[model samples]
Target: MPPTPSPSPGAPGRPPPERRTDDPSAVPSSAVGREFAFEKRHFDFIVGLIHQLAGIALAPHKLEMVYARLARRLRELRIKDFDAYCALLESERGAEEVGFLVNALTTNLTAFFRESHHFDHLAEEVLPELRARHADVPRPRLRLWSAGCSSGQEPYTLAMVLASSIPDLRRWDARILATDIDTHMVETARRGLYPAEAATGIPPALRERFTRRVRENGDTRTAMDDQLKRLITVKPLNLLEPWPMKGPFDAIFCRNVLIYFDRPGRTQVIEKFSRLLSHGGFLYLGHSESLYGVSSSFRQVGPTIYRRV
Candidate 1:
């Protein structure tokens, strides 16, 4: 009351020595607030960790892209910072979180009969040769693996090729094992419903054989027919995880999946694919990818195809 005690120096009337909250730059070195601000060090650590855990390399320039995808998880968890979220990833609950990260970061760019040349080669050269080779073997069986098959296109393409080219597909034990790291993609592939645009490049004959049209509320819709759908089995597969399908496959289509992996990661995956292939089996990579520097286990058979050597 005596002039409010003259508002004593550094007292209630005055600001409290520019406290951390009021001036972030003035925060004590030990205060966690200073560390909460985004730092390049933390960014690099996250990028490296993602590469290690998922074989998906998030380049330095993609720091914003990573933040855009993962920030939602941070918010959903009520986490105000990345450090705490990263630490949480080290725990058992982190497994699910890591799965989300992997799914988000992976590039699932794929379509029916992508790299059309591969399908042509399969129909004309590979399948014919396989049939001729197995003609003498009773109950001819063929196994093809579409590793990193996103939303069923590659495997569905494989099925279409097999169904069209194979003379006695009904009698043959032919199957395609389609897999991807993303569970959502796997489930979508299993549904076998594709937009009409997806069938644009599909040859008319193949489309007729593999797809059926239905009237959906006054609109015509096309979907993969039962026969083709029956030929492929979609499953969730993480290339970073242990191989679940026992193989000796006639061919393995792993197109476009390795571009995200570093040299060592790519090499490890190639080696595993080589082991899965039957002797003389073919391995097809994406047009932009190669096994040349990555592995010596496979010999180049075509621009994007390899033979287990």
Candidate 2:
């Protein structure tokens, strides 16, 4: 899961999207089992489009998942069948709905500090080494990227850790870049608002120092403090596309985002990360993901954590 809340589209470890050209139907077959007619061709088209757009490779079994997530859009647009839906996507005007399509299929499942050990490593090991290395500098510069920041939680967590670990944080040029392919999640992260319950996973001291409770209308919510917000810049970025920013980031947290991509796509992204990272910078991956047989640019330093070699 990502920090902010972005697409955790489907379960991890399933096969990559299947490529099939044997059956090509412009219309749905005569199957009356569901609310919408989701033919294999429709699924295949979707698979191809999503892969092209976002680098997410959908497995063959994701047919139901794709149908279920996109069905609401069909209903909202008042489209009748999968053929029509696919046709619309192929249309010139379909460009607008493409964003919505990507958003709909993407799910952001995250917590304030979903993976505690990573934060522990950041606090205990990473920052200290950086501080020592930068002691001669007048103002140390630290940049971290929450690459798949879902809603906002991950980068905010990074901010908290930075604030607490570095006593001279104000003297350092510290910033966190939080980006997600889902613009909806990027906006959500920019707002820095979350249900009060989401704050539970955050450590008590960090939460108290970095977050505040706000009552909007009749509902209570948690808002990140300006101090923490100052350290983050949230933006929408597709990992597979051309990047605008120059990097050499001190660290990159791209947790749980790679599971949706096929091996080649995953390898490409990681290599890009490696290129953008500082020589000794760290790379963090989701628990179920690994760099094994993917790349040799990093050396494993901790559980799912890597240091650039």
Candidate 3:
């Protein structure tokens, strides 16, 4: 009999294809990249560590989501693996790395007048009440804080409401202090530019008064009109850090930001917000969040809206 031919590489008759290791550190070139096999341990460690450090709790089920968000940082920093990335997070240069992590991990879902009810409350209830309280005061100034203000929408919305509803806004010394942990967002808010879609829910009269249309690439950019823009001053603020503002704000819109924080962090933030607010001022949380049992300083006034008692 002629010599039996050895089975060709990957031929059916050959020994079965070797199983690939699913481990990220051991994946072969022909196998899918390690990014997809991001270790659950790594994810758990990072999430737990972040929660411990900053009180941001990323759930265990968010492993894949977290990997997708932070994998780019690994590539950008030329790091080899998640472990190495975690090491970088622990180093002396960790502050900037942590910032990148925060930027990547934090959800920034917002639009102009999102949760329109809050704006309605601001216009119909809060602002009127604030004005009435200030009526007897000599200066009659109104101060609003949009804490964790993402890309400026909430603060800008507040400004528009004030401009439209408050007479003599230019003379009243009214101000909206909009702050976010992300510098990029702060700068974007400061620019006061938004895509036209952001204007959809805004009333036509207010849109006309508060937004100016400019064309670029045959698309319009709605620049917030000076009247509204002048009311908001955007700044970079870290909720985890000591607050820079000395505030006795009439109202605060800290919507959607506390979802990332754990119970203790949320409580701390609520206490801070309560302290920042004037007696009888308001605190607006995200629609999905509530202040029940979080702090004694606020009394629930509506769904996700609280009054400082």
Candidate 4:
């Protein structure tokens, strides 16, 4: 799919039908004091829609958070209440808003080498094993997938580590696929510009080599160097949808994303990853996620890291 464009702030192409004012279902009296009329029905629709669209299962506890996040959209579009907002989502005209809605609701919390140990393992163990295994290929290729890579940090970090580990990196074919369901985040990752503080987690040497400070709109920001950018391709991808790439990735980093999915959803996604992975390739998950009952295709080889069996 092509990159999703940002939604316009103007009202939807066509106005939603005016809901009956007297209907209790349209606007609950209890919502009278709130900034927007967010009833139980509206929350339910959001939960179901996000799950169907992104495979994210939001709990009931996230009701307030949902309202808080989506409320911004309401204000932006000049939408009166959740009733009209949900109607717009359900209508044909609302298709464009879908991207914005998903962008708003999806959580994007990432940093440069946020999970330090994963990179450590990649540099020390995984790279050595792959290096020895592909020693004979005329032009050995290395492919990695950072599934759910938010704002490009994970894949950029992967690029830095991959370049650092292999002395003949330029001689070999190497690419990192960075993807996220959120189109906005994909755009941000493509830009490869970040606040200076965001680079603190990266080692000083790597940071100095792979990134540089630039003035953007009068503020100094860190921009990823072309050397690092060349190794990564960022795209908007919904994991729940059919993937377009044919992959035999040497390693797949899908950290933290599975925590939002239920057991069955998690299993299905893991199975797809297993299919894309090269034999015995590595799969990395977040610290809180595990595949104990999700699949038997992998064996625990390190902390939250699995190797295809």
Candidate 5:
């Protein structure tokens, strides 16, 4: 079934949200003969806090997803049910759990070169122009931001593409700043290790150029070659908060990150991104999102690609 958009918190919703699924992994419910206490009221409080904290709107249908994800937290903290979880979130003591909660509930689906066309455009069009424009300067500066760089794929891809496409990559002042709201993701990205399977999506030539295999205890892992790794800086950044780094970013890949935000929040982020761009710099969005009715600062240049006007 298609995922439907439900009303926001404080609006009318189903009476306690009845759900049916045969998936054995589902949590114990407050329903008949079940132990789960995730009633409508509990869900509203949790989701409302998510909105307030991260500007992500949780649809009513996400009750199961929320419960499944956060149920582990309850187990880890030895809390019994959703009611207690909600209380802890509201209390002064809840500050730390808030981070854990956001980490748990946030969705991160990413892969290297997941949207191949964006990298193609960068290699074929964007980098060449930036290189020519900066050639006359003594210290050429290039900045790229992977604003929601989950698990490092996007930034690592950017690094690889830049290394291959730019003629004098090392001489230029070039860096890819990859940031994510989830602390764990930032750490994982820093490690630059991936299971062998993750390499399949990456093109063979780029993979051969930029990655190497490492073996530890019979596990063969693919690691980003240091040449590629040196060009990236990974750190935690909450997009809703003020960004610390000054930027005239040559390109920014903020794909799939804005869908979680409400309209006003998305608009604010788009404007901020525009300000960060170098004149005529590129912004890459997820395929499903668009700038229509959101902002006029950018004009579409390709599928899911936009350039600052």
Candidate 6:
């Protein structure tokens, strides 16, 4: 696929109709006395800032969500209004608050095995190939990356597949790098625990083998076992920034992450991934995402799965 130029703000092309952040007609009379009125200007500033910082394209209609999440930061900082909060963000020290804002605004909905098919593909197809390719080496070295590993489920799932696929994993050098832009999410993933209900998507035997039952503050939960924990490392990472690791990873799982980015941003990330991926490596994206017209670095090997060309 040929590379495309990034779109200018308010570009001439007829873009998709933006979903509005709020409905004026739906506003109740009782809500009129609110202290801070989130104006169109404030929303636009936020969208631009987030796009600049994280390469995430905030839809125009997500104003309500932006207002609601950032309101807590405003309250914490005792900022008088949305205008004042935005002005603060525009200031020099506003850089410090960027992480807080991102932590609050970014979505982190994930599970032990949210997309079961991806794991199945990894176990049945990808892992066997990796094992066969590395079989000759005494201590086979393998690396996998989970780019938007929200709360660590994706990497842990990958680790589970590795554990099940390869016999005598202790003799091999395997590592899964799990990273997220949200510091809070990275910390949560580092803790390696989840509510019992969050384990529903996990297969019964895998769940039994990997998570140990536990209780905290009268709430029953599950924690990743040592075997899974040893195979993974959780770190804070903003995908827009430079990555510190020099990796030729065997597989890179970046599912659902590109949905938040504009076309050019998506293309840029894919190209970067292409450079990081080893020959014949795999790239797994979300069901809704595709490589079509984005990059020719990969060939579609399955639904939402791509192999490096």
How many clashes show up per model?
Answer: 0, 9, 0, 0, 3, 2
Better of 3 and 5 by lDDT: 5
lDDT of 6 by residue, 35-147 (tens): 56666666777777777667788886787788778877888999887767776765788767767877887889887777788888988998888788877889988999999
**Candidate lDDT values, in order:** 0.77, 0.87, 0.77, 0.86, 0.85, 0.83
Candidate 1, 1-309: lDDT as tens digits: 001112123221112222345655543344354424444545666666566566677677776667666777777788887767767766669767767777777778878777888888888888899888888777788999999998887888899889889878887889999998887789889988767778876888888778887766776666888888899988887786677678889999988889888787788888988888899899999889987778889888788988988
**lDDT per residue (tens digit) for residues 51-129 in model 2:** 8778888897777788888889999999997778887877888778878988988769899888889999999999999
Q: What TM-score should be assigned to candidate 3?
A: 0.84
Residue 85 lDDT in model 5? 75
- Candidate 5 on 205-304: residue-level lDDT in tens? 9889888899967999999899888999999887877778889998999999899998998999999999999899999999899999999999999999
lDDT at position 77, candidate 5: 92
Off by over 4 Å in 6: 1-35
* Tens digits of lDDT, candidate 4, 1-309: 544334324312323455676876775454566798676667777877777667788998787788889988899999987778887887888778877888898899998898789999999999999899889887899999999999989999999999889989987899999999988899999999999889998999998888999999999999999988899999889887788989999999999999998777898899999999999899999989999989999999999999998
Q: How does candidate 5 fare on TM-score?
A: 0.88
Runs in model 2 with CA error above 4 Å? 1-33
lDDT of 1: 0.77
Error of 4 at 220 (Å): 0.9
Ranking by TM-score: 4, 2, 5, 6, 3, 1
Superposed model 4: Cα runs more than 4 Å off:
2-33
Model 4 residue 127 CA deviation (Å) reads 0.6
Better candidate by TM-score, 3 or 6: 6
What TM-score does candidate 1 get on C-alpha atoms?
0.81
Clashing pairs in 1: none
